[model samples]
Target: MASLELKIEAKAKQLGLGPIGIIKPQAMEGYIHRLFERMLRVPNGEKLHRGFLELFDVRQAYPWAKSIVVTYADNSIYYLPNVARKHFGKFFLTDNRYNINAPARKMIASLTAFMEGLGIRTSWNEHPGVTGLRWAAQEAGLGIIRRNNFFFSRRAGSYVSLTGWVTDTDMELRSTHKEEPCPEDCSLCIEACPTGSLSAPFTMNMATCISCANSYTDSTAIDDHKLNVLTGSWLYGCDNCQDACPFNQITGYSTEIDFPGLMELDHYLYPEIIADLDYEDINDFIRPKFFYIKSESLWRWRLNAINVLINTGSSDCTRILKKLLKDPFEIVRRRAQNALELLGS
Candidate 1:
């Protein structure tokens, strides 16, 4: 039998991963139980068992889908609005909802496909009020939670998304590890969040979070111009707190089998053009990497973008907003109209 480290190192390289690590399951036993319990404490957690079981039932897919330390790149800024704007958008700025981006979505889909192709089923869970993935990832020694309340792996920054496959293959357990201590004087993440959602270290007010808006399907409409402005340069998912963290600086880009490729931030920040994407365009060009964007809940993302662009008062965004008035997607057109009205008012 190969040593745990040797096997994991080979797997990481085969998957185009960056530096890899390991955490023994025994080391994570207590932490995983607590994390599972904590997630179950959520009101909706009771309903998640079906989903979890559905994922587990497909484990027959991959014979080699062993549990090793999975790692990705550290493109921290790519997920946030400010950093993404530099790379993707021209008219408006918003968060990089990878679910909608062509490259990112493709990567995610490919990963899922790979898992299923191996006869294993994968569950991509980001349910509200539950942190099972977080607990699992953290317990697996991928990274520790920082004061900014985001997972931070030593190799990849907070930019990595969490998704995993459970397989019939039980490989060696890597070491269970934790994040290094935070520096004494750093509070950038706390200060950068405009809505004060980072109310306390490791405790967030999801009800008041911009990211929360992207996650919910039936929450109150957050079409308020004032709230948009406070979203602080994010279009879909806000990363103000993560952007402010000093520990994230120690990270580098990912080497995962695929990272979101080729699309710019504009794809996410501008509602006027994105609403016009046909299903083929979404599936062929974008969906493989950003499957989450397909969710109808993206109305919140478009609305958030409109508010920020209007608040910037950038003339370039004016025509884009105007064009969006007749969008094929009613949600886009409605949000555009409301934004234009807010701008006029």
Candidate 2:
């Protein structure tokens, strides 16, 4: 029988995978310690426990999937339906969601099921940190961290999700020391934050971000001005800074993991769908991965989107806004009502 390393590599290549590699478990300790040090400096280190434990096989689901590896450059391209036609010719929304549509859900389920079959368990938690995943992938010999503080695999650029697994079998790799810190001159991701959320290099101030705020459910006493600026996102999420990265721009198309496409409805198709969403509809569809939005975040996002529309002088959505005044999601409805007041003022 072929070795586990060969098996995974063969499977990936057979599927036309972009780039993949392996990392030994023992090699992960240093980066793990550094991340812990950063966590200690941050306000609440305890909150990161779930994320920390997830790096190891908290549940040894698919032991053969143990080696941390990833496919890169998943969402560098997107089609802006409203302005894309006028500015970015021939650009279309990424159809990534299509592949994983039922398949994505099924694939995740299957992976989990396979883990269970192998006596591994999976647990859901609140917002998990990306650092642990990053560390594990690094230890697994998958890739290195670039100046942008995002994973920099030769193939995927920085667009890959850092997923992990555990297997009974140990994968072989040419042991090497962890990569050194990023180059000093590379400040692309920091320069890309429109809201200045990156307080220091590699540190994200989550409270002020559009993505984080957009996921919030509470609309209490939020700045109406800021909220209006958010609604510009048509679909589920935002990627302003990532889009501006030099590495991201040059990344070839990702062929490995195929779920989160450029314009996946959950991520980029903002204005139209959100304009029509009610509480129940949101709960059913948007709340799953977008739980943050169902909270105060969606309210802020709606308000921000409205502001973006008004500022752009895009009157096409006037009717939508008028209807949004009666939305079931109180935050969205309230904010839309307020945005109307601002427009009239």
Candidate 3:
């Protein structure tokens, strides 16, 4: 008779999740304490970090959750369009959480169903951070936590999508901590960081992070000149730290694996096109896809595109900037004015 652990591993592979890792769930005291400390120093820390405290303890949310099974998808497998590759981070490019029919989403569904058949109660959490996944994955022996604050498997690097569920059952344990978490005192990711947001090893300033800045931030609210200049043409998200990692420097993207709606998004994401999107276009065509910026926040997306145009600096971009000056939103109009000024137009 096969053990439940072996059965779970086989099912995970069958669903294309690659492998499965099971570990005892407990309160991440160290991580939680750090978050509490951060909440005291940074602006909006209490509002942002408070909610995730409960997530650090699996029993807090699910009293019956004795263990968690973790699985990951190597996103290096998918090929993204050039525009997407340029404008968006790889994580967002391969993310299928919003799309029910996507292969990654389907893999989770199938894996969950297969696990439940083994007669174990299950509960899955959505977000990566609040769940203290970096700690969980490291404790579970699935991967090593790199200095860049990303989990890297021996094979997949940091370009992996993580999914996990808490359950009442505990499986056999083994540690696969491969390479040195910090090889040769690598500070490449910290140096490669544009905004100097990586303040120290494994510590990032959320206030200055380009990824954090791009989310839910109005264009009018972006006050840092250096941050704007540093972000360059990253209109949606940034990935400089991950890109600089030697471990992430791999090739041979899978021709067989595909992201269902990723290719089609190229139409709406070109900086020139997104800069001119109207309310209807933004709501119907754009909001459903990236969705970091909320409805009625057209200024944010337009500003992102305008900034991209300004940084790229082309004759066509100047022309588009001039046209953007006539946009309905005052913030968009002022941003276009600033972009044109920066271009000496």
Candidate 4:
């Protein structure tokens, strides 16, 4: 009889999804404890990461899970404009998770189907209910966690989009060893972070993280710190730490597997264009692609644009802020007003 684990591995490789690894559905020793303590130690940590408490009970989150599967989607094939790269995250742009036609999506569906064919069950990655994929990757021995808290497999840099799930089947373990830690003397990622959220090695303060500041909920209110250069310039994601990492120098990104429809996103990704997006554009163009902001809260985009302009402090950025003084959302209009004043417009 063919080993189900090997067949699954072969199927994943056939779909351009390899380096797949399996492990028990638990994080490494003290990872959860260290993370929780770090988060709670910061001011307003619970408010920023309210969903994090759920990670405490893996059994409750995955009652039927027998093993955890971890895999990555390479993001090198997508072509992002320089202007877009400044304001958006590479993973969000090239992410194949929600795109039904993308190869990564196809691979995920294929694997899920293949497992179900043998009466096995599967569930998507419950990131809030589980720990970060960095721990899972390390536990599975598929990748290493950089000091910046980003995952890097040997095949790809920190640009890879992580996605996986738990399955009921007893899959074979791909690895039982861990890689060496980052250089003790190196603090490049920490030094590169503009927000100072990465104050220490491998730990992050999400409340002040540039990427975290981009997301907003109904209760999210405007804060004075938004105008600070640390969190203001880059609207959606920050790449400083990743770009500074030595391991991210992996050579094959641009020439690797292609991500479909990535170039098309260049049209609506600029800070200038995003700031003026209307309700129709929000639904048709913005939300469908970069959806960290809620549909009802498109004002956040305008606010981000204003903050970025404030950081620019250029005559052109000032002109754009003047135009935004009439934004429909009161919050956006107020933010633009303040931004223009800051720019001496």
List TM-scores for all candidates, in order: 0.63, 0.67, 0.90, 0.90
Give lDDT tens digits, candidate 4, residues 100-198: 767788888888888789777877752332445667767778877788888777667778767767788777567643445688899999999887888
Better of 2 and 3 by lDDT: 3
Stretch of 10 with least lDDT, candidate 3: 215-224
lDDT of each: 0.50, 0.49, 0.75, 0.70
lDDT of 2: 0.49
True-structure lDDT of candidate 4:
0.70
Lowest lDDT 10-residue stretch of candidate 4: 218-227
RMSD of 1: 6.9
Best-to-worst ranking by lDDT: 3, 4, 1, 2
lDDT of 1 by residue, 239-323 (tens): 5676567776665332232223434423533543444445355456543333345545445445555655665565656676787
Candidate 2: tens digits of C-alpha lDDT, residues 1-345: 876556555554544443445554455567656666546645554463335544544334333443343332234332234443221111123322223542323333444454355453433221242225566655545676654456655455566544444444445543343445555776767776656665456565444555545444434325535533543442333465556566566664433433343344433345445455664555555444343454534454455456556656666667778887776567667767776786783
TM-score of 2: 0.67
Error of 3 at 48 (Å): 5.2
Per-residue lDDT tens digits of candidate 3, residues 1-345? 988888888888877784677777653566677667667655676876676687688887788877878778777788777777788888877776666766878888887888888898887755553267766777777887787888888767888888888888866554677666577667999999988877566677777888877765744337566777777878877889888988887633445666777666678878888876676888887777666777867678877777677677644788788887888888778877877776688
Model 1 worst lDDT window (10 residues):
87-96
Q: CA shift at 264, candidate 1, in angstroms? A: 7.1
Judge candidate 1 at residue 168 and give its lDDT: 36
Q: Quantify how close model 4 is to the true structure by its C-alpha RMSD in Å.
A: 2.5
